[model samples]
Target: MDDGKLARMRQWMLTEIAVETACVREQIGKAQLDPQVMDVMGEVPRHVFVPAAFQAEAYLNQPVPIGCGKTISQPFIVALMTDLLDIHSTDSVLEIGTGLGYQTAVLSRLARQVYSVERLAGLAREARQRLDSLGYANIQTRVGDGYLGWPEHAPFDRIMVTAAPPQLPPALLDQLRNGGRMVLPVGPHDHQALMLVRKDAQGQSSTRVVLPVRFSALEEGEAADLF
Candidate 1:
């Protein structure tokens, strides 16, 4: 996208459509995401991550189909979750559900390290290529079940799960560092809540419901069979 075209698109987002998306605006303020997060949301070429057919509606502040029965979250939702995680420049973040890597790109800008997992090998491969082409050197993508989280890189400073689980995964809790925060969607497909979980220095954890939301169910695995 050319600089002039990008500028016009961003102007449309900040001035035109932002007001219509009430949930987006509410979440942005409630989550306390950096004002710059909105700027990044405006700047990123969301259309490129989606099918060419949907490019026209990419900046509409709504989810658009991206094939594989998956859809990228709305721009504001991405920003809200990123904000809830409270990322620091030196922190390492673990992200579940790579989807199209748009969220991964946003996280890369705020954190020192990012480890993203995608259940589908095809999606993981494609997202890796896209992020690599965009020169996001800080992001590392792996093809695997996100349910188990990434044990090899346990104790991440922050964790964000894009897909909603019936309940937060215990494995994810184990992977978070003390004092770390995690943002996730929890509940069924038809109804859900965006949640923030924090682990204190004493290893105690607590959860707070941030907003109503919905996402794809977290996949089960061999580990789940044990339950």
Candidate 2:
């Protein structure tokens, strides 16, 4: 993990996106964006979060396998969904699917605290260690069924689901505080749409599709252990 090398890669990646060579701009054209999201994206070391075998492609604006049949979402999608949250500095976020902890790191930079869940025990443990090693202290992770949501930390100010579910999970919606926002991909294997969910101040919620997306389906089951 060479810090300098990661810094270089991140810079190159941002440049690629800014120059439109990676189609990040085309993919998210004129969408609402928060400069802070871009700052976080620029700061996080994506290569270190990716599996070593895929490190070279870490900054390519594409998904790469990390294991357990999961792949981190492409950088543009991550940035788009994160910006859609409109995260506040004081907001607390619950993230479904920790994956490689890259998004967790980004969320930690914007939110007061982040609670992330992963179905696979190995990925959970590895992500926890990687995040901790990278100095992300605001992230809490657990290995379990994300559909159930983390009831102990209920009423989060925001929620983000990395995996696509056939339908919205009621528990996750319940866990979101009034006025909270959630971003996730919904639908089937062949096609899915990134959905933005907003819980109004009156406690009613609304959802709308933001963009077409593809993601591994969310799973259910008790993990082997926290490891």
Candidate 3:
């Protein structure tokens, strides 16, 4: 409703996320998320990223469906994922799932540029329009198979995949520059875990399971050729 009320709700949501992080500190390896990540999370209006019918639930810490059989990630997961990337202001990020542009908007705030790939045409169009309407100039979105990653902008400084792939895609690893990091969910449909992959200067990579998670499967189709 009112901007003031929404701001209050947003802060409350951030507080809840902090408490949740503390509850799982042993597994997540941190009692609190990055301060910049928290600030960006608080600034982004998640309500605008979901359908009007679900705006009332936007401030909650849970995921809200955004149609196309997808849901904007839960607030805590968004904060945690963003925190894990450790995005720098000069970094170029490749986001594998655009959903409704909520996470894209967050990335635009933290990085210099963000190339997002969405599998659903409708979702891609809407997410692009929404981000444009919000004046997110540093973000670019294309409808395609996120599994393929965005080759045109290869060797990204950071990558964030919101969908779960049964296994890591070789293209993504190849697209990450040395000393870069990527965060994503990997595993089968019934079982998935959030994974962090780091590429060293020598081009060697290492992975660690951050925590258990569930996300829509990464889709692949001929439409990946679409710009």
Q: Is candidate 2 or candidate 3 better by TM-score?
A: 3
**Model 3 lowest lDDT segment of ten:** 218-227
Residue pairs clashing in model 1 are none
Name the lDDT of candidate 2: 0.86
| Positional deviation of residue 21's Cα in model 1 after best superposition, in angstroms | 8.1
Tell me the tens digit of each residue's lDDT in model 1 across 1-227. 67687667667765543454454555445423467666677766776777778877777678988777889987767877887787888999999999878898988888899999988777777787788888889998887778899999988999999999999999999999999999999999898999999999999999988789978787875322110
Distance from true location, Cα of 101 in model 2, Å: 0.6
lDDT string for model 2 (30-68, tens) is 533577888888988888898889998998878889987
Best by TM-score: 3
* Residue-level lDDT tens digits of model 3 in 156-209: 999999999899999999999999999999999889999999999999999999
Clashes, model 2: 0
TM-score, cand. 3 vs. native: 0.97
Query: What would you estimate as the lDDT of candidate 3?
Result: 0.92
Distance from true location, Cα of 139 in model 1, Å? 0.7
Instruction: Give the distance in Å from residue 75's predicted Cα in candidate 3 to where it truly belongs.
Output: 0.3
Question: Which candidate has the top score in lDDT?
Answer: 3
Pull out the clashing pairs in model 2. none
